[model samples]
Each structure stands twice: as C-alpha cells, then as structure tokens.
Target: MKQEQFLSVVDRDEAERRFRAALEPLGPLGVEEVALAGALGRVLAEDIASPVDVPGFDRSNMDGFAVRAEDTYGASEQAPRRLRCLPEPVVMGVLPVGEVTEGTAMAIPTGGVVPRGADAVVMVEHTRLDGDHVLVEKPVTPGRAITWAGTDIAQGEVVLRAFDVLSSRETGVLAAMGVDRVGVVRRPRVAILSTGDEIIRPGTPPLPGRIYDSNQVILADAVREAGGEPVPCGITPDAPEAVRAALLDALAVADLVLLSGGTSKGPGDLNVQVLAEVLAPPGILAHGVALKPGKPLCLAASGRKGVVVLPGFPTSAIFTFHEFVAPVLRILAGRARPARLHGGEADGARTWARLPVSLGSDGGRTEYVLVRLTEDAEGAAIAYPIGKGSGSVTTWSHADGYFVIPREVERVEAGERVEILPVAGVRPRRVDLVIIGSHCVGLDVVLARLAQRGVSSKLIAVGSEGGLAAVRRGECDAAGVHLYDARTDSYNTPFLEGGLVLVPGYGRLQGVVFRAGDARFEGREAAEAVRAAAQTPGVVMINRNRGSGTRALVELLLEGTRPAGYAVEASSHHAIGAAVAQGRADFGVAIDIVARERGLGFLPVREERFDLVVAASRVERPGVRALIDELASEEVRAALRGRGLLA
Candidate 1:
C-alpha cells in the first residue's frame, strides 16, 4: 500500500459530496410490470386508468323500497301515498331482469342494480312489509337511495399515479377499478461486503486486536432502511487482488455495493488501492473525510456500478451509512426515507435539568455522544453519558440517543446542558441501573451488558452521601460507597447504621474523578452554584442535605462552611458535577470516579468503601440477590474503574 498517496483530508461536507457523486451515475431502477397482488408493497411504476364507470348504470345504495319522487310528493307519516307493490326483487351484484313499470315500486337491497322506472328506494327498516305489500313510512324523494353511475370513480380517470406506493387500500382501489395487473418499480439490489484482515465473522473468537465484524451487519441494516435488498456479499480478507475480484463479482449482480472497513489509510489500504484500480481514470471519487470518527471514508464508481466504503469503527460506520447510503436507498425504493424513528410521540418535554454527568467528543468533528435519558422529579429530561471511546462497542448498545457536540469544541463542559435526540423505541421508564455513589467511567459497560441481555437500565450516579440518602428514601435500586465508619473501623457500616441490610459485594477504590487530561490538577476542594434556577428563584449554593456522607465529610473539613439557608441541594454526585460544570454553587462534595469520564475538573474529596444497601424487606428478594451476584462479578470491578467513590 505505497504509503497511501498523500491526499488532503476534507470535512463532512466534502465526504458527502464525494459519496453522492460516486453514486449519481447509476440510473434508478425503472418500472417493472407484475400482478396486482404481487405489487402490494412495491411502488407504482405507471399510471392506471379506468375504462368504465365504477358502476355502468344507476344502482341502489341501500336496502329499501324504490319509487318515483313524483309519486310520493306530499306523502309523509302524516298522509302516506301507498303504491301498488310490483312483483320484483333485486339482489347485490346482479342487474334486475325486469323493470318496475311507471307508478310502481320495487323491493331492492343495498348494491342491487336499479330497475327500470324505479326512481328511488326507501329503507326496509323505515317501512313495514305486509303480505304481497309494503308501506312507505317516510317521504320518498326522487333519486334517493339510488347511486348514480360513476359516483365512486369516473370512467377514464387515473386511479394511481406513477411512483406512488401500492398500499392495501391502493391495491383495493385498483381491484375495484377492474385492474388485474400493476406496473411497479424494481427493487434495487445492494451487495454488502465486509473487507479487512482484522475483521472476524460474528461469534468468532477475536485474536488480540482483531474484532468481530459489526460494520457489515450495521451497513446491511442501513441498506434495508434505505429500501434496498441486502445481498450480504459477506466478508473478504483485505488483499488488493481479493478486494478487486470480490468487488468485480459483486458489481455483476448488484446495482450498488457497500463495503465496510478499510476506508482508512491504515495498514489495510488495499480497499483504496483496488477501488481506484477497478473504477477507471476518475475512480476513487474521494477518500478521507475530516469528521472525527469517520474521516477515513472512501467513495468510488464506474458508469455501471458504485461503491461506498466505510471506516472500521462501528459508530462511525453507522453514521456514514446514514450520511451516504440512506438517501440513495430511498431514491431507489421510490420513497422518502423517514427522518424519525417509528413509535415516537411528539414529546412535550422541553424543560431539561443538568444532572451530575460529563460529556466527551472527538475534536475536529461533530461527535455524537450517546446517552441514557430519564426524567427528573418534575418530569424534566436528564441525560447521562454512555462510556465513550471509538473502540468501545458497549456505547452503541447502552445508548438511548446521542448528543451532538460541534466541531473543535473538544469538550462538553460538565453541567453545560444539551439536548439529545433519542433512538426511537426507547421506554425510559423501564430502566433499572441505579448507583448512588460517585459516577464511574466504565459503568456504561454494565449498562451495555445488561442491554445485550435485553434489559434497559438507567444509570443514576449519585454521590456516596447521595447514595445513602437515596437508599434511605427509596429513590434508587442500589447504592455504592466507601464511607469510613470510625466507630466500626470499617467502610460503609455506619452509613447503613440501622434499617437497611448491606448486600455483600466486592470492594472498589473510591475517590475524586476528573477528566482524563486533568488527572494531575485537582481543582478547588469546594463547589458552588453560579445561579439558582428551579429549586429556588435567585439564590444557589452547593449545599448538602442530611443524608450525604460527602456532605458530612465536607462539614468535617470546614465547619459551617455551607452558607446559611444556602442548603440548596444537589441530588447526587452527577447533580453535584452539574453544579460544578455550570459554576452554579461553590464546590459541593462528591467522589472522583463519576467525574473522570467527562473530562472535567475534579478535586478528590476522600476514599470510601462503595457498598449496596438493600431495603430490609427487599434483602431476600431474588432480584436483590441477583444484584449482589452481578456486583461480585469481574464486570463490576471493570465498572468501578475511575468512578469517584472508589478508594
């Protein structure tokens, strides 16, 4: 891979342009004729015209007696005009063989053909039937109860326009209009290929840095979402010869090809080289975007076929798929790709509160940080970041939606509030992850694992003191802390003091957590709020409530340092982090673990033994035991890494 020719890296806009330009040369799949029944979900390829009126002759619209309006003039319940009953009857789907001569009535049901000389039909319900006779109870009007010809659909009218989707209702319309066949647009077929020596098939054991391929599956999903059929051309080890052969073969059967991985100028530059070779003089439309995660992108095409290559990173690849492929998919399917996910309701949740959580984003690109969202006490939206790293696959599984940070902004200062567009289909109320002490870096790993098992858990990283308070108040499922119980010479015992039972779990080192880069500089030991928004109107303070171990520790450090009536509360470590991020109140108290993942400024409060407290009544519950078991697993220790309260 000759050091991958030096090409200037462009940004997101350039990347999209290159990609779209590559795909533009291929023509859309035109209309194909098929049986009406088979075109149920396909797009209409041509207009359909009805040759005859929906009903060629006047017909009965209801089941009633038919009569001339003139014969019933002034005839009402007050004074009825009874007509001699003519010996005639009509049924649905059939034309009358004889006519009711002038001044005579005929019995006809709904949809029956109108008889000669019959001008109107009265409801059978509205009239009484006597032996060989019928009495009209209401006034009869001319043309009443009779459906005129061409009422539903007129002759020579276009029933379906070209490019319209053939819904069941649309299909029924054609059937009613006497159409036995339909013309539909052909479904675009896409060949999905995964290329790379480092990519492994799903379920295969990984070797060192090698990883199971998820890009292809995600890309295929993108293809399907775009209204194209995914042929799943499968994985091929990266070799220029192999890449060229596979691409050539895919082009023979596919309208387009989606290749995941190898868009970057890594050791596997074979994709770039081979695509350029196969695509002709103007091949390799573009390579290398300026976006943070997906910068290593590639686009290439010839007159007959096109190829879109995405970087190996899962999140980047997914984003790129939506960026480049989704539009084409819609065009080929002859429908617009929906901008919003299904099952979403118009959210009235405009008010949001800053909870104790940090934000991360790659520099130079608008990074989309995935988060778990929940509502606060007042039903305000609150978001917490999912652990992030381009390589962290867990972020994808745990996130409900993503928060976008604009380019070159490297950091989302803790407490700086932002909106999140949630992934559709999320039920925020079903979350179960609740941790009471300092937020941790890898807690998101636990969330992802839980999600993998089909569980939705909300991570509540409240501080050690907040944990105890929450546990006492029944605000959460579990609490973690490393509180020094001087009387017991142990961690967390005195915090439990009485009512709650401690569930045995492994121990973690707990302390102040700060941004990865701020590892060395410990900021001011105390925290304060710049302004108060909701709990009070004008005043704000980094105050603590009665139950927090962090507050107790803070009180021990500076006697009565908390301002009078300044007892403005921070609900958890995350809430405290928010206070700090927004400069709301002078430093409040918290452990270090929760602050580390956000790249925030953190001051170590103290080391505490993090523990989970089960309500006395809940101690024996199976779910409680399960919590304890999971806490004891190796995964928990991984979760505890860099969390504020760990000692």
Candidate 2:
C-alpha cells in the first residue's frame, strides 16, 4: 500500500465507526463460572434463571395474629371482635405446627411461617390480649399482611440478564436465589507496549534527552479501569523485528494490544508501517487522526484481535485510548455500549459546571479542554482551564476532568456552561447552578435553603472580579460579588453594567484578622493596628488574591505602600484567617465571620455589600429563580442576622 493512504488524517467520528465495525466480529470473552462472592463488578455471561423461589414459603410480613379473614370482619376500636388465641406465639424462623380454625387466631411474629388455613394477619398493635382471648380492633383484608410463596421472586424466573454488571445488589439477589456460582464474562486481556528509542523505563536514573515510559503505566491502568485485564509488555525498542516480535507475542495472549508512542509521521515513527508489514493486506484500517495532540493515532486488526497505536504524548495517548480503546474493551468484555449522546455524559456519569474562563477551538476538529473543579466558600463547584500541553504531567495532578469543544464551535465564552467527563478517581457531581465569585459564609445559608427546595448548586470562588466576568459572559447563573469602589464609597453595583442584574445578597463586615494574643493589634484601633502591623519588623502580612474584594480593600488601606509579604496571596477569607491562626502570618484581612469562626481577634475595616449578579438571559432559569426567591425568604435573612451578613 502507498504511504499516501496512511497520510490522510481521518476525522474522529469516521475513525470510531470504522473501528467499531472492525471489532464487531471479535465477540465477547469466553464464559466461566465464578463464585458469587467473587463476581462483584463483573459482567454476566448468561441470563440467570432462579432455581427456586425467593422466600420459598408463605410468611407473615408483621408480628400479628394470623386468622381467617372472615373472623376479623367488623372489628373496630369502638366495637371489637373476640377470638380464641393459640397457646404459643410463632417466632421468626419457627413454623406454626397447628392450623387456625374458624373463630381462632394465633400470634405470628414478622417473617414467621404462616400456618395452614391462615389468610391474613391483624397487627398486634391493633389488638388487645386478655388471657388467651384476643380482642381485635381493626380488620386486615385477605393477603394484606401475609407474603405468599414465590411473591418476592418466582421459581425459574430470570433474575439477572446477560451483560449486566454485577454489584452488591446482584450478589444479594444471587445469594437469595441459592446460586453459589454464577457465569460471568472473562475479563479481556489487553497487552500494553511502549515503543521508542528515547524512552526509558521508570525507576531509572534521569538522563538528559531521555524520557520515562509513562504511557505504558497509563495505558495499563486505563485498561484495568475499563474492566480489561492488563498484561504489561514493557518497552519495545524502535526496531521493526523487535516491534513485530512483540506484536505477535501480544496477539497470541491478548484480545487487544496497545502500542503507545512511535506513531507520529516523524523519522522515529514506525508503528503503522510495521503493522502493515506484519498483518499484510487489509489489516491497517485507519492511520492518523484529525485530532489535536492525538493526530498520530493508528488502528489495526489481525483476525479477532485488534491493535491501536496511540500518540506519544501522555494526554494525547490517554485521550485517544478512551475515545477508541475503551469502547472496544467494553464490547469484547460483553459490556454494552453506554447509552448516551456521543461525547455526552457516559452512563449519566456527568455533571454540568460553568466555565470560569473562555475556551477557544478550531471550527474543524474536536478539542478537549483540561479543567479543574473548585468550590466557592458557599460550596458551588466551578470549572477552570488547567495546563494545555498534552504532555504536561501537571494536568494529571491538577485536572479533575475534561470537556469536549465540538468541531463546529469556535469559542466557548467565559461562564458558558460545559459538560465535563471526570477523571477516573474523581466522582462526578450533577450541578444545578453555577455560582461564581466572592467567598461568603452567608451563602452557605442560601445553599441550605436551596437544598431544602430540592435545588442543587455549585459555587466557584474566583473573587468578585472573576464572578462579575463570568456573569458578563453568561457562563453562570449568577455571580456572588462584593466589589468595593473607593471613588464611589459603595459596593457591588458600582462594578455592574446594564447587561447584568444585581440581586441583593448580604452585607459583610470586612476587618483585620489576627491571632488571639498578637501584640500588633493589642489595644489598638482598626486603622492603628494595621499601621502597627506594617511597622512591626518580621511580622508577615498575608493578602488575598488580586481580584478579590477583600484584597482591593486591603490595598486601599495601605495606599501605595508595600508590606513585607504583600506579594503573598490567599484565595479566600478562610485561607487568610488560617494563615494567621496557624502563625504562618501575624495578620491578614478577612470578613468578620471568618475571624469569629477561627477564634481570632478582629478589627473592623468597613461593612461592604455583597450581591449576586445574573445575566439578563439567565434570570428566568428555574434554578436562578429559586435562588432569588430563597435569598428573599425570611429563612435566609434570619440566618444571616447577627452574623454581620444580614441581607
């Protein structure tokens, strides 16, 4: 085949369809019987029909008197019906030996076997016992308090379907059905190989120009996360014979093989050419991709086994594996394709969060933006872009998830909502409202009120400026802000524009926060204490981030002077208070609530107004409306009262 055939970079959708068709004939893994105790998280290999009925005998649902239904007719509180009680009460796990005849009753405990000829049970609470004579006050209809045989699970019924992922609930069902062993699909074996001459394995001494083989470990873990058994083949040096030998060995034992690195069109790249030579005609289905960071992707298949050549970069290799490899693994392991919109929430494992900053993408190819989640002091989650390089290891540590920017979208403006697919270890949350900016403890009350109304919200602390910016871009439902204008001697609305609507949030007392026995503030006024702190040598002054309202106020108080630690910044009031409390700093500016909560001394700076800014377009959303109403509710006001944040 000509090299030109492999040069054309196919689109992701086209590549996906081709790979799916190619791997379709591979079929599911062979079935094996596993002990019910060991089958958790494994897919069922076949439908399991119960061999016997669950709770195979008729039983009482409650501790009561089991009797003929006709005997309890017309029994009431005012007018009671009397019956002869049996000598002994039937306890749980004990079967009643005697049958209840006409006008006779027997005490039956919950889950106790029902005696013959008993049609219903009258709750013991509804009856009074008088020396073997029972007075019934209420009547239970036939079959009302008794669970008939086979009612919970019928005999020979299909209790579990093929391809179902078994969890504790399924295990319990199996145990209840008396199935000690269950047929489950064997985990597909995936061979992971890293190929490159410059690649060095982990635990080796660092050498200049030599990179560690991180892709192998990443791919191995990814395969395991997707329910496949990983067989690590280690590193294969970039030689055709060595590559071919590794490929053949992997194919012999692995249902799927992943070769990371050496896929680019550069001189060292040889995975596609070697695959073509080894598999011969009609083996390499697709080569190259129209995706950023993953353009070097290659797909190949030999008989029932498949091979994927992932890009060299860590992020690109991970991205491509999830896009192409995970689905193939799922199919081979007898796991059904998760029903969802393409690139949408997978199996409903998605949470919507507002973008803190604008994201841009070329209109031609799909782009994934790495992001990290942050919660505001009020606990709403906000997502912000993280490191951009596909090879940056920091993304693995910092990012919680990634959101796909569709091919047609040129830019996702700041504050625009985006769907995020979470990283493996991070559990995803469903976000109802994206509230960005200013950290306020008072908002916690609003959150509780919103939760009581069954509304979910996510708060991202980006400071007042960041919140206002997000609101301006329409990325969030609202932004909590406490911007103070020195010129106007006012707060919040001074920074607002006509495109936004401000809803009154609360009033917070800004103050100087210091440790309990700090001498800098001893018997000094708010302004004098601040001046003394500046003058006192070796006293560290913690500051808030640049965009925060508290930082702005602190700057105003200093007036063009640089304190010892003015460059050092904390993101929230809690952080500032923590620095002071832990002796990391002598004093810092924070809200009164934080000072009180941290048991620190406080000196009042100024009371500032905090409010939520909403885009005109978002005011009508149900969550936005609920929040507005909640803020106005007396519950929020009462909670905010005396906390120096009363609305």
Best by lDDT: 2
lDDT of 1 by residue, 113-138 (tens): 77655657888776776676666777
Q: Model 2, poorest ten-residue lDDT window?
A: 339-348
Candidate 1 local lDDT, residue 208 = 88
- Give the range of the ten consecutive residues with the poorest summed lDDT in model 1: 526-535
Q: Rate the local accuracy (lDDT) of all candidates.
A: 0.60, 0.76
**Candidate 2, after superposition: displacement of residue 485 in Å?**
78
Give a tens-digit lDDT track for model 2, residues 1-647: 24654688899899877777776665577898899889988998876766764556666878889987778889999888999998876777776778777799999988887776666889889999888799999987766576545445544444566666776657777887788998899999999988888999899999998999999888888887788999999888888889989988888898888998877657776777788878733587788878887888898888657888898899999999998899778767876433311233223367777766677777999988877665442445567876324422234434568889989999999767888787765554444567877757687667756654546566655678988987776557899998888899889878888878999888888889888877778557888787766777666687777888887799877776676557556666765765576554678898887777668999888888889999887788777888899889887898889555756
Task: For residue 603, give model 2's deviation from the true position in Å.
Answer: 91
- Model 2 segments more than 4 A misplaced: 1-6, 11-26, 76-80, 197-212, 239-242, 337-647
RMSD, each candidate, Å?
29.2, 27.6
lDDT of 2: 0.76
What's the TM-score of every candidate structure? 0.49, 0.50
